[model samples]
Target: MFGAHTWRCGQRYDETMTLTLAPDVQHHAANAAGRDFVIGDLHGCVDALRYLLHKVGFDAAHDRLFSVGDLVDRGDQCEEALALLDKPWFYAVLGNHEDSLCAVAEGRLARHRWYAIGGGWAQGLSDHALATYAKRLRELPLVRVVGEGETRFNVLHAEFFGDDADLDAGRFDAEVRERMMWGRELAFNAARLPHYALSPTYCGHTPVRELRQIGSQTFIDTGAFIPEGRLTMVEALTSRQWSISVQAARAMGAAEMTLP
Candidate 1:
């Protein structure tokens, strides 16, 4: 339960605080239809996204694409990246970067803090564009769940710290919610693995040298913002993973600009 504080994303929480989680997949296409795929942190690299989508034969009319959030920042195409939110085939779970942006828009966080965290690209937006993006960011859920039977998958921005029994119960509160969006201890600390009842959780936020798997969780941020990094994607049902190198992406005209 949230303490006495103002709320922004529907649920009640302190405006000065942060949190995160979600489960429900009734909207995805059936197995007979196109596949469901998840992509890593996309920090404004729409070109890289386009290349990876092509490589995977992504059919926007059939296949579904889910982003692990951080879709805007540290790259040049933040405006272009927002196009995914309006696409019928695309879905996304909120990441900490998005949270920061939201906080800034809500006047809960300083513009400097957002700028400090690779959000300078937002300054280029028109008034309408900024409002549009802020509204969309506010509307994004903290989590997205898909699959059934024995292959259920939970997509969140960061780590899930709730008890396994609470996974499907939809009982995430403000504190746990913040952890899901910003927590790194569970994603990076190999020795502190907690047994999440939900198997095969896919998340990003804490960038890794590669897609890392600890227990039932998988971290796929892959540092796409770095020149040496690449955009990573995975077929949820088959566990077939693919990556598009930053250099390759640049060669394909995906690297017009970058952030440090």
Candidate 2:
């Protein structure tokens, strides 16, 4: 059960909860020459991502795309989606699905556990391939801070249950990282206090029908792998959005294949 703990409004921490320390954060300077975009969970929908990027006129040469993670699983093009990590302009924090991949690859978790949660794509993969994927995913930071000053914002796969100082200093432990990858209390509980004071934070683990914001924390997963869901992307500085429906993207792809 991920994030089984209950969280109440204004509550910062539960001292009784225990988790190890795993600190990793990545910082990027603002894209002064071009725009910066933060996208929702990929969930292996590389084609939809491509369509959305094309619609947005994303410039790979100058623009940057930051992901909320979950770059694998569910959809058919998991490998293609994961390869985006190699792109110089693409950056992502580690999502819970990626965390599970690491756990399974390192033998910390059972294969069945992973399979139960949309990991069927890796069933045929060799151990070496799995290890390679895990190694790359493990390098992703738990949180990514983009830009500076008022334009600055934070990107994490899930919830962050701390203040700006705690986030800035990277004081969260493994439990915190777990929550960052799997927690849903903030997204589920509308009354819960916002976690950060300085920079707005974007997260994706908990899927919603549309992009939502509670205080400074924004949720944008949008259920890209589901039948009726869509992959969403938002401009980091302006909150402008672009979305591509999964069904529509697939239909378009199929239609294109039949043509010249």
Candidate 3:
């Protein structure tokens, strides 16, 4: 029932009747043919980031990427770091560093504390860039999301709420606080996420010797900022699958992105 036509080099076939594919598989194949990938964290490693994207064949023109958070501070490429993430297709959450920027600016935090944690990088920043990053950081939501394919994930620089304490009422300023300022407590404490009952959460901040999965949760931070430069990336279409980047390309993706 199919038809075929000989062309320049090969033959083009019309599979109107020749072959059949299940609806789900067909949909999966079609939708996931090429899609954007969401990455966990990047501490200003612009070259590594570019290498990773290049290796994965991620066409930035049509596809999109979502980063958990942390665009600057303590990294080798803070200026370049923010620039790389300035694209419309790229979406990210407000990271702890961003939070610190405001806190330090407002005098809520001591200058010593800020520098101790890499805030010194901002010293070289132009006033305009500083203002811009501050404005953007304030607008950043706590989460970055990828809600399609077999992979559905929520990314945060830190937790939605403190574990021992409750954002449900008063937690961060009242009961308990975490110095790391990432999402471990929130992931552990949140009762249930009706929307993500089937999906897993991907986060950074907690470095593991090896990337691991529990139930359906995923930990992606290997502390690339440290000497090892170990980082992990998961395919945007496949849930519960991850690859560690060696040349940075090892964690590559095969999709395109549409600027957000």
Identify the leading candidate in terms of TM-score: 2
Write candidate 3's Cα lDDT for 1-260 as tens digits.
Answer: 00111001101123453422111100011224356665656776555566556656777666666666666666676776677556866766556666666565544566567678777887766556665665445555444444543554555544442221122222233112232244354344435532224245555666665655543456666665665755555665465333444344334531232212
Off by over 4 Å in 3: 1-33, 126-129, 148-151, 160-198, 237-260
lDDT of each: 0.72, 0.79, 0.51
Task: Looking at model 1, report the run of 10 residues with the lowest lDDT sum.
Answer: 20-29
In model 1, state the lDDT of residue 141: 71
Give the per-residue lDDT of model 1 (tens digit) for 86-177: 88778887777776666676667777767887989987655566655676776677767676656567788878866444666656666777
Clash pairs (backbone) in predicted model 1? 19-177, 19-178, 20-177, 20-178
RMSD in angstroms between candidate 3 and the native structure over all alpha carbons: 17.7
Query: Which tens-of-lDDT digit does each residue in 147-210 have in candidate 2?
Result: 7778789998888877666777876655786688788888888686554574788899999998
Which parts of model 2 are misplaced by more than 4 Å?
2-23, 192-195, 254-260
**Clash totals, every prediction:** 4, 1, 15
Pairs that collide, model 2: 20-174
Winning candidate number (lDDT): 2
Q: Arrange candidates, best lDDT first.
A: 2, 1, 3
